[model samples]
Target: MMQRFIPLGNGYSDIYELMYIGRAMPERVRHMLVLHPFDENNPEASLALVMKPTNPGNFQPIYICLEGVPIPSKRYDLWRELADELQHDVIELTVSPSGKFSDQEIFFQHLIGILRTNHYLPRLQRSF
Candidate 1:
């Protein structure tokens, strides 16, 4: 199975698009996540949704809006509300900021490891 992060753009207005996916395809939503890559003093956050793997392709896509919105903002509230309506609890975690990595790919790789280790995402199966 292959796992990937598909960025939806910075939270700003793009958050609506993320919400729409959750509402339109509620069954595909596996998890809702809020990643805080900085200290508590920082108010910005990243939102993400992990979707169930595709049937034919076995591709698990994690949609994200990397650290772009403030925690108490309307967008963040809307995300939480969507999760509630979908009966999914938002999972929050503190992680190293994406800026620490050389590129977005590396940053997502780091997050994948964390999600797997924490049992939020499935471990990769080895093929003999």
Candidate 2:
């Protein structure tokens, strides 16, 4: 199966759109994740939605807002809203900030590693 990250703009007003997708596609929803990065100086958070492979295409999509929001420790309401809308538990993972990586590819590679380690994502060469 093929997998990729689809970026959604920050959690300003787009959050409603994100909620709509989760509520509308409950069957396709695989997991909801909150990624937090805490560096000595910089702290950030991102929300992501993982979906099951589509029929006939076998493509899995991971929708992400990237490191656009401040840490949820300061804004728990967003997390609560997301949990309520998805009607499922949200998994939280601490990871290195994307800014640490020189390129977007490297950042996503790091994310994939974290997801794999947590069993949220399939292992390399494993078919979905």
Candidate 3:
């Protein structure tokens, strides 16, 4: 299987797009993730939707709003709203701040490692 992070714009107005995708492909939705990172101060959270592999294809796409929304835990309404809309359990992972990485590619690699370590994603394989 191939996994990839497909970055969405920050979760401002772009949240609507995320919601639309979920609603449109509810069956494909596998897991919902909220990655939180903090430095001296709390930064925006990254919201992601993990979709199951497509038929005739083994691509598991993780769609994300990369860092720029209020932490849902602090905002009960938004959290509840997301939970309700997703209609599935959501997993929260606290992670090192994105700033710790020198670049976006590095940040994604770090996230992929975290996901694999936590058993949220499959271990890398030479062949599927």
Candidate 4:
């Protein structure tokens, strides 16, 4: 299965879209994540939803709103509500902030490693 992070903008509109996707495709939702970056002073967090891989294509998409939403806010509450509706517990993880990486892709790679290590995601299958 090929998994990729599909970034949604860091804003109110983006979060609404994320919630919409979760509500629209509740069955596809595999996991809900709250990525807390290493910077404790930072008030923002990244929200994500892992979707099951598509049939035939085997493409698994992890939708994310990157480090834009504030913690303990109405937006976060909305996310938690969505998770409850989907019957999933929000998975919280500590990670290096995106700012620590030179590029977004690198940051995503790092996140992938963490998810796999924590057993939230399956190990990558390499075609030799």
Candidate 5:
């Protein structure tokens, strides 16, 4: 399946938007992801929404906040609250910072690699 990450800015307000997407489309929410990536020397956390692929298409989307928040636990708490409300648990992963790469495209590629390696993402020759 094809995957895409929809960046929704930083934390706080954007997090609310992320939660809203879950509430709005409960069926589409395949799962949630909490990505912890260090920014420079400061470690931070972020949230993402993994959406179910559309019918007749393999386009699955993962909405996230590329820039992380100062408090990892706080972001995780927000995700917890969302999980409590949704009655679904989110998958959490610690990854290398986007800053490691030269640009966003490469950063996303790195993330895609991490996910696939962890079996979170379908393999290259995956059967659909």
Candidate 6:
């Protein structure tokens, strides 16, 4: 399966897109994952929506707002409100800070691996 992250703005306006997508495609929405990773350098969080893949399709589109909004901070009120409104519990995971990674791509790769290992995503198959 293929996973794609669609970036959104880091403000209220951008957050609305997340809300809109969830509300508009409630059926397509499968799960929500919230990551709270922090270090001495920066404290932040990410919200990811795991939507159901299309029938017979290998693509699994994941809409995300990376550090879109300050998290674990009072600013996180918006995120809390979203979960409350959607009535979906956010699967919170504490991970290594993004700063620890050499780049954003690596950090995201680590997060995806975590999800896969935890069974959030399907594991790879091996054929002899």
lDDT of 5 by residue, 83-127 (tens): 888878878788888778898888887887887788777776667
- lDDT (10s digit) by residue, model 3, range 1-128: 88889887877777768777888898998888888886658667888888887787888888888877786444324644766777977788888887788998788889989998998888887763
List candidate 1 segments past 4 Å from native.
Answer: 39-42
Which parts of model 3 are misplaced by more than 4 Å?
72-76
What's the residue-level lDDT of 75 in candidate 3?
Answer: 39
The C-alpha TM-scores of every prediction are: 0.95, 0.84, 0.86, 0.96, 0.85, 0.79
In candidate 3, how many Å is residue 128 off?
8.9
Candidate ranking under lDDT, highest first, comes to: 4, 1, 3, 5, 2, 6
Better of 2 and 6 by lDDT: 2
**Residue 42 error, candidate 3, Å:** 3.9
Question: 2-109, model 4: which lDDT tens digit per residue?
Answer: 999999988467999999999999999999999988897776999999999999898989999999888889999999998998999999988999999999999999
| Residue 91 CA displacement from its true place in model 6, Å | 0.8
Instruction: Give the alpha-carbon lDDT of every model.
Output: 0.91, 0.77, 0.79, 0.92, 0.78, 0.72
| RMSD (Å) per prediction | 1.3, 2.6, 2.3, 1.0, 2.5, 2.6
Error of 3 at 38 (Å): 3.1
lDDT of 5 at 121: 70
Regarding lDDT, does 3 or 4 come out ahead? Answer: 4
Give me the runs in candidate 4 sitting further than 4 Å from their true place: none
Using TM-score, give the best candidate's number: 4
